[model samples]
Target chain A: MRVVVPFAAETPKTRLESVLTPAERSAFARAMLADVLRAVVEAGHEPTVVSTAPLDLAGLELPGEVAASASVTADDRPLTEAVNARLPGGDAETTTDEPAPVAVVMADLALATPDALERLLTSTADVAVAPGRGSGTNALVVRHPEFRVDYHGTSYLDHRETAREIGATLETVDSFRLATDVDEPADLVEVIVHGRESNRAPACLREFGFALDERDGRVDIVRNEDCAAE
Target chain B: MRVVVPFAAETPKTRLESVLTPAERSAFARAMLADVLRAVVEAGHEPTVVSTAPLDLAGLELPGEVAASASVTADDRPLTEAVNARLPGGDAETTTDEPAPVAVVMADLALATPDALERLLTSTADVAVAPGRGSGTNALVVRHPEFRVDYHGTSYLDHRETAREIGATLETVDSFRLATDVDEPADLVEVIVHGRESNRAPACLREFGFALDERDGRVDIVRNEDCAAE
Candidate 1:
């Protein structure tokens, strides 16, 4: 089955861009994108990044040869609407006479693993959603390409409902890594803690030298600049 | 008493600079410095920022007034050594008489407040360290300038003990705001949360509204990038 990774940049909510050096935001986005692409390739499927800020990729290079695409809407819409609008259009091109399944992943999953994707494909359910300790779903995969669903607020519950509406089996799996997405800085702590175990940790993370404590969660590591410059 | 804010860039055992955009690091430093200066000025004290980074304050303008000074160090020594080395040296013009008490604050304190600084000065103790929930010491004020002290490593407790050994009265105060410092991204959450109430808050944080629930300790608000961008 082909995998489609959907991603978008939310427009600035404030004038934070004016304060940040251009180098900082670019570095942040590049590092995050690298890990998502790596997860896709490690799963033995090609990945595509659909970004609103497509030009942000000019300087940095990503690993594993994943393709890049831009969202059609110049006017930013809700994440679910934009991502869902992109999926159905591509579904027909990838499907054969007997259509195969597709995995729709949120590109921000910091701890996504290849093994998890493999399991997602082989699972008995028509729809699978990975839920963390927090309420929202991080990822969802459908066994039937015809399974129509829009991932948005409370996606975990939405996916389960979508499975019932489509008369397809719903499955839940225990995946600590796949359940977490980088929505807030707090979410970043989890990745810094356990990212080494992931199949494709972006070079940025490795460069950051993320240190994990199995017990205490993510601890802050003093950076190289802290040592070399000051 | 004149406030001395010594900013140290601590080097961790691991380096994570590659993941962070240069802009992010610079923005983080600039933002912190702005807030710290604002806090100092609001408390009705002369603000001197003793930075390890090169101080070229030609273009940088802050609210109220701030003085920028650089510590002369050839290499990266321990954090304590670097800060102490920059203390107003005893030149011919510099009198031998005792200088007024100074509040040595961390540059990265997320919850730093003018009220906390005033409270710290009210006590007659030789030294006061603000301790948070965990082992982290957020801010420290020394009323007695004659006593020599150094802060480095996880040995904040040992630093306090050494202060006592030198016949200096050491005290610890519980401060919710002064206890949080931003060394990692996760720490940024607290700044974004509690900073809403601070007079030193940046234009960005004020633009992005925050609902701080003191009971549950959750900040509910729509995240915005405009503040940072501006």
Candidate 2:
């Protein structure tokens, strides 16, 4: 099946801004989007990235087809509506005749690893939703494009409910790398707490004059006691 | 070589009075000490406990050999002094005359697990220090009894230095479950963070009234959050 990556293209939305600083938000979005595009391209498939924003993401080194949204500011619409409008969808549950499946991902997840994404896309389950520990969906894969996402109060929970409404089977898997998203300052703290020592984002935060006092595998907002010399 | 467990027989100094109410301190201390003993027993190595404080911990449900300390507080002295003072130290370092390697562990590691402890003891290294992430020594195994342990400031670092001084090779391994000791309130958070789901001290803390705002697999002492509500 044709792989579809429907992402809202705006300069940067406030919902995204509320979670990460401007630099972090831009880096997070661009990096994750590039990562997903790389994974799809490496699998010998062309990914159709449907974005509602301008084509300003040109400079990013992505290895897939880029499609800009026909709308002005695509950030205000709900997540599923934005995605379904781009892929082949109708009033009824959107189903596709493609032999394989389409993988849908939100562009804001910094925790999605290539291995985990590959596993998620290659999974044979009828329906899959990558639910964040908090109340949100990070990614989803459906064998048929006929499935419509219910992106309402708590999109993660709503997507699962939508699967049930459509008589689709759902399964939860333990994926430490893919189960997190950078949403709020605390979420960034969570990322850094579990982040790899070589990860660039946390180091970028540190280099950008943000002090993160980390100890015992927990990250606290920069505090004076931790800032003296280290 | 014989395995030696050094414990302070006197109840842990009441450092909790500043943070915990009298009732809370009493309960916390009792639970902490009890778990320490239980963990040592659960780890399957019945220790020859050399108590620095004048009290009896041998009655707990574990195989143990107890000896009372000649001093009130054994501070800053090399642990080698404390341990060797109990065992026959003369010619103890010789591989031919002395027994095999001995494991020296503090009795205050309340979160130690039998599986992890077995892993440490079964390791073939001449000397091994189970490394906790931050600066602290939880447990170590020395093949030579004559190998002196000057556990000085930040003994985790000092332990490595002492190992080098004794001409012993040092190995670092990650099994925090077997190496965490309850020394400070922050250390107690480590116990609560990685302690087994069935551990009683943290459970008792929650039962009495201590809130652990767990985030990203670590516990934080946040007050307004409900512990038992989960």
Candidate 3:
């Protein structure tokens, strides 16, 4: 099976701008992408980073054994179209009689682990999906050639319906790490709180001098005074 | 209209026991109940505390003019049955020619504001429901006598079905304060973060030595040494 990590390389993580500068957002996005790539590599899958803009993969610390590739989408299309183009029956040039299943993983899943990716990729169903909170399709393994993705309003529900229409056996994987995508300021709190053990994203957040603190009677991200002075 | 606050006073806030002792849970539960009651009173409504055990309203600091009552269920019935009994066509006996609408509000809405409650009570639908973050019905306004309450699994969906069965128009009120209910340890983070601006629940949590802190890469409630000594 082939894995594709869809990344919004250009103007990424707009929601996180409230807490992070543009440079910090770009660096954080790359750190999260690296974290996801490391997990995919650890799961014994060679992942291709499908980016919006040309990405410099030389700086990324991927697993030594795993051969990772980077490709830029021809156009600035919706995530669904960009990811769909890389699938078996998609527009990408390929010469295999039987196209292998393609798994599309979101780049923002900073908490995802190798075990979680292995579980998603190993599902026997024609189409396996990991649903995110608030009706989102976080990651999907599309084994069926005819199955396409639609990331518009409540895409998880839409994907389920599409799978049924194509007579594909749909399997839903409930994973906490895969379900979490860093989108809002509230989400940063989760990354800071849970990503401490992980080296990539949590380390990046700490290096950026961000810490969770209760300010004005609410939980918010506060800059460490010691780090700020440095 | 009369407002009814359903409280699980016996084992209130079992989820918070990880951070709070049994005594602290009881105190926190009472503080949240008081906050909800204060909102109901400010909304120009008299609220009754429908609890598992008989409650002492004299201890609660309610508004001066708002007269609050307390009632205990004969048995540990499901929340549906308990709240249903307080409705117009419900088990509660009525002598007037027309039965006034009754609003059922959950006791754990720590951030509930007066304006939010007023919006719910003033809704013109035969049955109005405030949907919680998960599958919970935080509050409901039943103006139609035929309308009933169902607090089963995913009760908000069940309530909508029940309203349709009764041919009553259902209005869904979306209020951040009304939508938030303290259920899990993670929920306490929201309370500590958002409730700081509010005096009632935030003050009570702070007074109990509870504060948000990151431990082992997760946001958790921790006690201050000075406050613990107190």
Candidate 4:
């Protein structure tokens, strides 16, 4: 089973700009990507990283097998267009094989485990999607030849419509790990709270000197000052 | 869109017998059944209640439209066998149809609303399921010709296996309202806590003189003696 993990190389996760600097955001995005990739690889499948631009994987802390086998492809198209092009018959420029099942696991699903990925991959449907908390689609496995994706304005709803229109069966996977993606500054706390269950995202945040603070009944992630760059 | 709302008519919800007497438990079960039937009617589908024994809906206090439209069927077989018998080919004694979509929404999903039911009905999959929190399936819409249900241990997992074996596409609806069912004593607190959203289950509980007590950081449902057994 081939699985693709999409990572935005340029200005990734801009919502975290309030708390993370440009360099910090990039590092954190890579960390999240590594976390997602490890889950996919451990689920018994090699993963391909689809990035908006070139990614430097050197010294990028990943499991040995993952670092050795993972591949990257640079593409500048928008998410919807790029992903649709990956689906068979969506684009003659990219898709060059017979129609078959292609799985897309987004890089921002920092909390996903091998079990969650396994569930999504095993669906015997034309299209199987995991919904994002905010009505976006976090991941999908598309087997229908006519189904392509549209990522604007609640892509989860759009995918449903697309599947129905093409006479393809659609399935949704109810999963917390796949649904919780690191998008906003507030979402960082989830990584810390749910991190103790062997999640790598929390360790990534801690490596950058971030700590969880609970004061006045409010939980927040605060960065340590002593670890500032020299 | 014929929807079946299954109710166990005899000695129902024995798990709550500790908190509620036999009569009170029957009333509460009827209340929950009414709640589910109302949602189905509001979703623009007429529902049939497949009960284990005869159901007397005389004083069932349902909305006018639901009371006028909902119908019930008596079947003494186990849940899985009874439901399959209703399915097209599962039994020669029952179904005589050429296979079409049939939806089964358990009467215990007290939190379900028209919107949640509509989501399950709108799925384009061969089998669309809304899972229960404890590895059970609360509701499902089956369109596959060869698919049927098994209500034994972990029916959610069983249904998935059944679908895979029959090569039928499966979809899971990730809905909080559909996922929460009022089966255990603690589940009553959910209807009370989230009840303000026009849930009939909480109202049913209130009519039976039950209230939530959070005296010690631990929340519980305690029956009020003043309004009980008058």
Q: Roughly what TM-score does model 1 have, to 2 decimal places?
A: 0.42
Q: What are the lDDT scores of the predictions, listed in order?
A: 0.53, 0.54, 0.76, 0.78
Runs off by more than 4 Å, candidate 3: A66-75, A214-219, A225-230, B1-230
Q: Please give the DockQ score of every candidate, comma-separated.
A: 0.01, 0.05, 0.02, 0.04
Please, what are the lDDT tens digits per residue for candidate 1 over residues B47-142? 665655545443345642554322222324545665454343312114466655656667666457677666665667877776432244556666
> What would the TM-scores of all predictions be?
0.42, 0.47, 0.52, 0.53
Task: Identify the candidate with maximal DockQ.
Answer: 2
Error of 1 at A229 (Å): 46
Arranged by DockQ with the best first, the candidates are: 2, 4, 3, 1
**Model 2 regions more than 4 Å off:** A1-230, B11-15, B21-30, B58-80, B84-96, B186-200, B211-230
- Sort all candidates by lDDT, best to worst: 4, 3, 2, 1
lDDT of 2 at A188: 56
Model 4, C-alpha of B93: deviation from truth (Å): 8.7
**What is candidate 4's lDDT per residue for B61-153, written digit by digit as tens?**
777898888887798887888788766455623445476678999988887888778989999999999876435688999888789887765
User: How would you encode candidate 2's per-residue C-alpha lDDT over A1-230 as one tens digit per residue?
Assistant: 45566565555434546434565556655665665555455554556666666545466644334323111123345566766654444332255543355566665555455555666676777777665543345677776545666554355556667777878776543343455555455555534443445445555455544554545433345523332223
Candidate 3 residue-wise lDDT at B165: 94
Could you tell me the lDDT of residue A150 within candidate 1?
49
